[model samples]
Target: MSESVAPVSRRGFLAGATALGAPAPAVPAVAQPRAGIVILIDRNDPHVMGHAISYSGNLSRYFTGKGQAVPPIEVVANGLGIDVFRADKSPLKEPLATLRQMIPTVVFSMCASSKSIAESRENLTIQLIDGARLVPFGIGRMVELQRKGWAYVHG
Candidate 1:
């Protein structure tokens, strides 16, 4: 008995060749420790301020899950962004305060220069929200954080 050889179509040959030549699917490298993140906020809008605070809290929740170390999350506010940090002027006082207490790792920072400018303009002392720290300059502080391997995010 003679065995018949099947004829291969051009399309079938090319498809097989392509499949054989395809590279293996890429996979993520070994699990890496969560890195720190810096969130920059420069607008004076209440919505923007609230969004930044909420985003920081979300990041904190994600990084701190599974008993992982609480990576640093710095919310740096500059220019008019200082308005949100103003204790008396900010509308998000309640929510921001709650976030501060719930996630201490998510720190809020306002620019001293911006505070001075706002104070000069308003002719009054700008009291920052409780626990809000002041940086010498927002951009400068961001640069320092970036140099230290903290990822930068704009809010």
Candidate 2:
């Protein structure tokens, strides 16, 4: 007995070869434990600022609650939100301090542009609370953090 074998067409063979030679789809990198978080706060309302602070604290708790280490968190304040960082003007001075102590990795950032404008308009020097740093621009800082694979939160 003789057995007959079917021949593959040139088109079918080329298609199969192309499919096999195609590169696999790229995958997104998983977030590492070292990844950070950036929070944007641009409102002037005291309630809003309070909420932002609370939100950050809650995030820290979330990590700890899961028995995981908390990542670095940055709260960037701009526009009217800069007022929340003013040492003498902020109603949250004590709370801010407590929050910082509770979460050492949490940082509060003030926008230099907003500070300059606020000082010029209000005719009062702006003072930052302890642990708060100044960034050239709030939005820019957030963008940089995001590029570095940091999570983002707006409050």
**Best of the candidates, lDDT:** 2
TM-score against truth, every candidate: 0.73, 0.77
Q: Which residue pairs collide, candidate 1?
A: none
Q: Give the TM-score of candidate 2.
A: 0.77
True-vs-predicted CA distance for residue 18, candidate 2, Å: 13
* Candidate 2 per-residue lDDT over residues 27-67, each given as its tens digit: 57976646788888898888889988898899989999999
Off by over 4 Å in 2: 1-33
Q: lDDT tens string, model 1, 15-99?
A: 7767999654454697554568899889988788888888887777776686677678888999988888788888888998888
The lDDT of model 2 is 0.87
Name the regions of candidate 1 deviating beyond 4 angstroms. Answer: 1-35
Q: Give the range where candidate 2 is weakest over 10 consecutive residues by summed lDDT.
A: 24-33
